[model samples]
Target chain A: MAENYQHIQTAHCENGVVTGLLKHQGLDFMTEPLAFGLGSGLFYIHIPFLKVSGGPAISFRTVPGAIFKRTCKALQIEVVRKKFSNELLAQQFLDEKIAQGIPVGCQVGVFHLSYFPKEYRFHFNAHNIIVYGKENDTYNISDPVMETVTTLTIEELKRVRFAQGVLAPKGHLYYPKSIENFDKKLIQRGIVKGIKRTVNDMLHIPAPIVGISGIRFTANKVKKLRAKLGIKQGGLFLGQIVRMQEEIGTGGGGFRFLYAAFLEEAAEYLQDDRLIPISEQITKAGDLWRSSAVQMAGIYKGRITEQKDFDDAANMLYEIAEVEKTAFKQLEKLKFNS
Target chain B: MEKKDIPQDTSPLKNMTREVYYVKNSDGKYETGLSAGWVVKNEALENAWEDINEQVRAAKQAVLTGEKSPIYYYFVLQLMDYNVLSGYTGFWKFSIKKHMTSKGFKKLSDQKIEIYAKVFNITVDELKNFNH
Candidate 1:
């Protein structure tokens, strides 16, 4: 069963899981960008009250498990998801799925994953991987973020599945129950639905700490960070932003580039050249995000401590917020042939 | 970023795996590319580790001076804070705070000590007699 399962490396975990599982079910048109777009995965949120790893709780994509759930919903696929409080029950359930040759997606903590690099091992618990088969005490793992498939011992798998702290997996697993062929019209409709949802999320969300507003809110915080926290702590805060932006799963520039790629693909699928210009706009936004990261890195590295540097970084984010706002607004205005 | 301009700086993920990046090619079309690592991300990770190490060092010194318990040292070593430790052990924040003190830790029963040990993934003996 492991040999029959094809591993597809992706830029992010949830998107990869959605794409790989669908592809395994014979959805050949499925790609990372399409999964991301259809799932409305692009997002920006900085929870002011929450602190992760001594910094702000910042996420570049939608909440964990949303990509898989939303993508499957858009494609009208029946998804079976389960969570178990008992570790033994979880293992038994997973083993049964593997014995039936069904590839199952499991949510696990990154900290206990032995194959991950030591530096990348953190307390993040939303990472996703596929378990295609088992041999003795070892389970075959297809972590989308990795270049190749790996394996985890049964104990290791159980530990990660039941890892503690915030957003614990609790031995969660999910898979599409059955897949059926659909028409091109369904794909077009899914793309439009995804784009509309994303536009609303980025532009119309009422919360100050979400969507385009959240980017602006974070920029405002960045401007005041140095004065409020002083040089040492301020630099660490900026470093946290850079880490969240350019980390492995982001596909660079806090997923702006990935969103741009999605928009480009959507344009081709919808046969709407108008989306091409919007995609270019997103690409520019991604470039600005990269530049902002470089600016933040300058302060984090302690080479540039002046207030001006902090302001410059904040200004870049402000520009990004505006650019993303425009992109989403354009998406909102575009009339799709429904 | 442009295909030719995507950064490939050496980073902690050097020998582990190459990460995917979305970049523009010569024809200005979006495509997926692979990068070993980037300097900016590496710096952020290194900075985070530095902060964690600093906290661990402080916890060790506090434990050695009898200001904190072995549990406090293990908590910091495991990259956990009071909030996370409380969540893991199902202990109240104030209880965990109290347990971090040398006096409070000494008053803990074997059963309570075992809970902390399990959360830290260590033996009860290790939790009881952790040396820095």
Candidate 2:
């Protein structure tokens, strides 16, 4: 039997999957921004030693499953998550869950998902989607990134669930078993706590490769890419940053814009007008980040190699760091209505 | 990129769903948008694909010359770097690297081969005779 599952496309995967799953549980429908904000999805990290697709790692969001897990914890929602070592067992469990009328959110590799664009397929295994029903050999998919619902064969589904690489899905599955109407007061508290945690992460993390420091740290390395990695490798490395920011997880602007959207919605919900301007500040900062990626894309395409352009892009990051520092500090000091 | 500046990749190979990107507009807001295959974003992706393709091509060339083992080709096909493959297979990076060479690959014990085949999601026979 095909269970009724709503397919709502959103900019990011995990948050969208969470939103869809939560709504399917008869809980008040949640927006993607709210899910992201409650989950504290905003983050930044640039690991110089860790290579992703032949270039250093540059990530804009919290690690995979962090948002969904944290948001569920904060809301005190009854949810269950599991990781399977045996592919057959995982499929069996999924079938059992669907037979029980539960729509399960699954972590999958994007490379083998037949619905994805051919060019977009990579070894990224952290993509999240919903498996609501199974009809013979086909599983009904509610992939949050796709514009519409799709179906996958049992073999194709198994391949993606068992895909190997960093952050492999490991046939991970999660779903809410029980949900009640969320209290507005509790939601407000969750939002405020999420904001405080994000602010601290952006400003307080002592690691040089995380938070605002990481931005500047990456900028410094980017400036020396030509000298350190040589011309061709440096160009490719720079291109990897563009791919990470724009193509991978980001809807655009390295997820700063999405965070900005969350903040804007937060402002309205919290009834704190101050958050509106802070949201705009973050949006402006997101613009600058996008500009840097745009300039780096130019560098990758061999259009601009001038040190000045690289310098300008690095300088733009420095400026964004400053803007974020100020905005987050403002957010930290913000008072929510009790 | 300007709407007009986006590349018009009319090639039959272009995949519409993959080519589309979420981009920021002039007003500093992001919207799901399409890119002409020639944009810098697409170029970056193309560069990644090229690197992945090169690994596969090099593995095939090495197999043809009998310079490396079929394991090397499968490793690349699995989208794994040496470090990742080593970590999953419980072998040192150097050991994995050594196994890639024709001589070392031929000397593999069944236990080691079983571990590798399991990691790669292939049968032992498939790992041994991976001409395809």
Candidate 3:
């Protein structure tokens, strides 16, 4: 879908030909004229094959911190990489395709670069990156003008001597000011369509079936794919399940403490009703998990004389898988109801 | 001056913040030296000097009681990211910086580092741990 949009968008922007043949392309947008107050920009758009299936394996810099910074950093890396310090934000992404600076399959979005006489401005590949840096008398990419990988620091080097990387608490995400004017366009080009191929091709991504995104898309769309596989997407809440477990007896024993937490979050986007909120789910999953674990213990102990421990564990996991399917189906079905 | 001052770094820097690395010399005492680089300010930084002050104080306390800071010994700790730049809520943490017998040498493991980031609620890049 994203690639199709880009194809037409590129032809329209580049060749100035709004060909009807560009049907699958994504340029058919009609918007109430945006209030272009500070807007001064140009860009061309195109689709690259970086798009991944299994939802293109999107990674969220999940380390935690400001969501904006993580997003900006991604933009920054690409912008500086393209060397388009002169392009307009509107067209920076389009220009990047030509710059051939960044490896192919990487597209610029909303990110552009500004060129100045003394210093090349912008730290990130993106222009108008939210964080600003101070450079010389003029505003440019922030730095001593020389950026060092964190490992080059004395502290970092010291760790390297031991063959281990320094582990520092990631506090925040920020980029130099120079890249600010280097606005990003199509920064989304590959993100929506480019990054998948790049990661898969360059990194030899292990699970091509799933890409880098740990979450699966069938589950993202159909919602009950996990249940269809006869398993829960995440887990079952034990706290809530404890109440029900006593009611369901051995049936509720399959819950795990971690279920509710992942489910609660999963529900926010998936919007399933039977989904337990994260907090209650933890305790609830724990309660249910523990009971099931107890019952499984009896079964295992009884079977231990005849079966290997690994086999028993596998059997237990399978049992848990069954419970997950029931809960996911219930939650999903309830989602439609609500 | 000792390393990494390369002429090939043509990328101009702006808003460079002067930093001092407090290093221990042959005399077994610490001295501050200069290192300048860009200081990127996040309008939405989550951890403030206030939140980490206790840990700093704890480190200082260790220094006072002949127990060096965990940072002094390990330079690593678990972190929780509240995600709110101005103010954080629902954050949690634990200590992970490792202790080495040698002076001025701190090491962190990749796996443990990943966990430290998860605990800190930060990305690996933002951990002041990435090169670019």
Candidate 4:
């Protein structure tokens, strides 16, 4: 019982799933940037005390499922979500949904997904994918991050769905029950609110390890780590930051670029000239952030050894924090007449 | 931070297939294209692999020394920590940690062994023998 599901690869997983599932429900095609923006996905946090997969926690975007949940709310879509305590029951329920011609969104652990490259596979548990159909014992998977539709055995799928870890999926499945049609007015309001929210959080958040302050805090932590951990171990820690930036989802400076892309799209949609320069500003900030990663990587690879070199990398990030601060403040002034 | 400083060595990620990355292009436009394998990315992943391998190696050594059980070795090799293993087997974290020791593993009830086997995707006999 396989439906004709179109597979669209995206830079990030959750937005891609939102775009794909919305399209599958006969809704208008949603661009990745639109989904990301409407979902209010731009965020930053660097919690040094918290550890994830053995490294200090550094997150570029909002938590997983935030975009989907926010975007669905903004779009006025009603969705049905379920989580199964039993693996067999989960599998059976998924089969029934497919038989009923509904494409289901699921959260799974990336570690057990057989199609992922071994180097990319970790114990990360919040990865999203869609199961649109089943043939024999194989489930057709539309993994948003992958280039095309793939197949996984039921046993393999179950293992990934029920993988135990931080943020375990527990066989979670979701599908939209009804999609209400909306026009450009709703999109404009969503964009305005999204930009305002980003500005407020980044500029006004009291937590030192969140928003623009978090970037600066991370820089200070990195400089201190260079002194305490020494070169070899410190380099690994620096590399973990780079990994958090580049390897995870569309991270590294990629989230900044995505946000910038959203601004570009929002500018065209609203015909607002103010957003164009802000988009350009954010793009430059993203570039500086990437430069910081590159410099950190230089230290990580032993190409740069001096403490000054590490300081310079941290300084670049500090500069980006300032750049983002200015750009987002301008975004806060955006007004929608709708 | 310049491009010239990026190390060109790709040996660390030789086992991995090259994948596409959707990144911003030079003109500040988004482009979905294959990444020119950067040494830093490979180094980061290599660091993670090293951590996992280090734990697995230590677990194997402990098992051989009769200090810990073979279940301890497989638990790590399967990429599970004690907390995750506890969640899967419905045991407390302290109890799971205790079961990692040889003496405690030997004292496990048959039902507990079966539960561990199911969670580990192994048969009960395999869980019992746990031949590396």
Candidate 5:
């Protein structure tokens, strides 16, 4: 069976407290009272109408009085729930919105999470598919009313990348090479937190190998989804995204495994041995990586499952990375013309 | 039971009206007057007040009484053109009412087109005609 994890937490708001489950960074789990408003038994964050929103954290509730009555805000805490799924949380959230006129748009997508090893799937039935096999994974996930799901394969999901550069087409938003170049820089600079350097970093690899570029494209596609009715770009927003990288020569503990895979995949230029054992395949995940991409694509379509599933995929990838050196030689000879 | 001329769009409480006259098609021009109504009625839409009332009441009563189906009042509001104000369900009724009319529709429609043009850096004509 695939690996998984779940976290549930109970929050106390003015309207009362409810237990919620969250996987990723956001507060996606359902609240108590199952209602939407602070007054509706459910504790909901009080927000304004079209008020300018800041980045990852929007600061509000600073306002006092009636405006703060049932005011609510979502905070990320470990999930403590024993039961949470689409049939429960999904429908509950939908009903709450319709009844109270929350109208935060309809369910756009679903993202399933797994723990321990870490993996993700974007479609709703992804859990079922993995457990039951793809035999009966028949459902039009693209329906306007239902959300699409996405998946992740590793411990840490590479944020999606975009194409943008000098060679980028007129209408094309991002340049592929430029984006790849950026990922290489991240590896080259290399002093990263909570991550180790890999072969990709030593050789200075690109994105398609490591998976960030695919993510950017996936996010873009999610934007095109009609059901989500994606939010409008508030205004000309610009900020720096800071990423720490380790020094190239001192490829110590910090050099990331993802980078290593990139370097090995790029070794096609020479007669030297590339792909190592499936075990040492951590630097860059291969077919497993592709399947994760498919999973992520499914995520863009809006399906997500439990944390253990995400972890299983990640652990599998890590295992693929730890494989033997002789296997690498065999893989190197297997030229993929793609 | 057919309701009288769609009840002049007497929708319930709301904060922001998604129906704030934005165009859904790639064309970038809001469909105003009767065209907008037709789009909402058949293609896709949240049930309007009259719709909500009848559907909600009947469904609730039937659920309570264990009936097969509620008294489905299939009303015809196509001739009423009251759906132009359908967006008022989630917005401030007083303010949205002032803007959901003839002149208000044109002004908001133009502004909506202009907004997209600004973001995508295309022409107004391109935005409007593009959705087609």
Candidate 6:
């Protein structure tokens, strides 16, 4: 079952799973950037009331399963997704799929994933992986974040699959059921739809805690963090942002650079030269975010503790918010021939 | 970021797989590149671990002084907060908070203790007897 399976490394897990599964089913055009683009994976939200691992819940991308679901929906591919309430049934279902030689994607927590580095293992439960085959009691895993394929024992897999917490997997497993041959025009249409949705998401969302407004809100809060929460707690807060933006599977710059890469790919696929410049704009935003991360690191590391340093970081984010706002506005105005 | 500019600082991911990143080449085209690690991110991760360890130490001290239960120490050791512990054991957050106290843990039935032990992946005896 694993003979023909090819492991593809990607910057993020969900995008990698979607790209790999589609490529396995004979869709050669499936790339990580294209998958992320068509899935509208770029997003930002800061939920102050929620805490993830003692830090404020800050997300750099859309929700966990949205990429796979949206990418599949846009491509008109039939898929099977299941979440089990019974552990035995979940194991049985996965075993049946593996026996049938069908590679399936499973949502498991990273906290108990034995192959991950101990320091990276937290209570994060949204990690995605592909189980292509089973050899004895071990399952062949293709975690896209890693450089090569890995394995997990049956018990280890079960533990991670049933890891209980916020956004628990509950033995969730998914696979593409039917993949039909699609032409370039279908992809072009998907690109248009994806960009429209992303433009709306980043610009038209009414809530202050999401999209561009979310970036500004977080920046405003960042300016006052030292005064409001004191130095130690505020430094921790900045460190949390840095970790979420750079440490996790964001492809660096909190998915901004990845989105820019997506826009570059989409420009070529759609034969739209206008998108190239907009992609550059987003890249500029990504560069600014990196600078902001560096500034934040200095403050969090105690090398710089002045309020002006904090203001400088906040100002960088404010500029990033403007850059992204303009880029999305341009995308919203551009007409596509679909 | 440029292809050559990607940071390769020492990190916990050392000897493990490098992460994939999107970067620009000299030609200015975006491409996927492998990054060993970055110091900025490493420091953030280390800071987070430090916070966790600090909490664990405090919890251990509390348990040793009979101010809190052993379950509290185990929960902190496992990097779990009250919400996560509640989710795993199917207990209410307030109830779990109460169970963290010495008096509340002393009254726990065997079945309840078994559930906590299972969640922590430790034997009942180990859970019941935590010296350090």
lDDT of each: 0.90, 0.79, 0.25, 0.79, 0.23, 0.90
Q: For model 6, how does the per-residue alpha-carbon lDDT over B43-102 read when each residue is reduced to its tens digit?
A: 888888888999999999999999999999999899886667987899999889888999
A1-338: candidate 1 lDDT, tens digit per residue: 54699999999999999999999988999999999999999998999978778788898889999888888888888999999988899999999999988999999988878888889888888999999989998999999988998999999999999887778899999999767666667778889999988888898889999999999999999999999999889889988888888888888889989999999999899889999989999999999999998898899889999999999999999999999998889888999887
- Candidate 2 DockQ category? acceptable
TM-scores, one per candidate: 0.97, 0.87, 0.20, 0.91, 0.19, 0.98
Minimum summed lDDT over a 10-residue window in model 6 chain A is located at A177-186
CAPRI verdict (incorrect, acceptable, medium, high) for model 5: incorrect
User: Which candidate should be chosen as best, given DockQ against the real structure?
Assistant: 6
Going through the candidates in order, state the TM-score of chain A alone for each one: 0.98, 0.96, 0.24, 0.96, 0.19, 0.98
Could you tell which candidate, 1 or 2, scores higher by DockQ?
1
Sliding window of 10 residues with minimal summed lDDT for model 5 chain A:
A235-244
TM-score-wise, the better of 3 and 4 is 4
lDDT string, candidate 2, B102-131, tens digits: 889889999999999988778999888766
Per TM-score, the best of the predicted structures is: 6
Report the lDDT tens digits of candidate 4 across residue range A307-327: 898888888888998999889
Evaluated on chain B only, what are the TM-scores of all the candidate structures, in order?
Answer: 0.91, 0.68, 0.24, 0.73, 0.19, 0.94
- List, residue by residue over B1-132, the lDDT tens digit for candidate 4: 222322335643344333334455666565555443666677777777787799899988999899998789888888877667877787998888888899999999999988988887789998788676
Model 4 stretches with alpha carbons more than 4 Å out: B1-31, B122-132
DockQ of 6: 0.75
Q: Please state the CAPRI-style docking class of candidate 6.
A: medium
**After superposition, which runs of candidate 2 have C-alpha atoms over 4 Å from their true positions?**
B1-38, B60-67, B83-95, B109-132
Query: Using TM-score as the measure, what is the rank order of every candidate, best first?
Result: 6, 1, 4, 2, 3, 5
**What's the C-alpha lDDT at position A263 in model 3?**
37
Place model 3 in a CAPRI quality band: incorrect
Q: What is the DockQ of each candidate?
A: 0.72, 0.34, 0.02, 0.38, 0.02, 0.75
The weakest ten consecutive residues by lDDT in model 3 chain B span B38-47
Where does candidate 2 chain A have its weakest 10-residue lDDT segment?
A: A245-254
- Relative to the real complex, the DockQ score for model 2 comes to 0.34
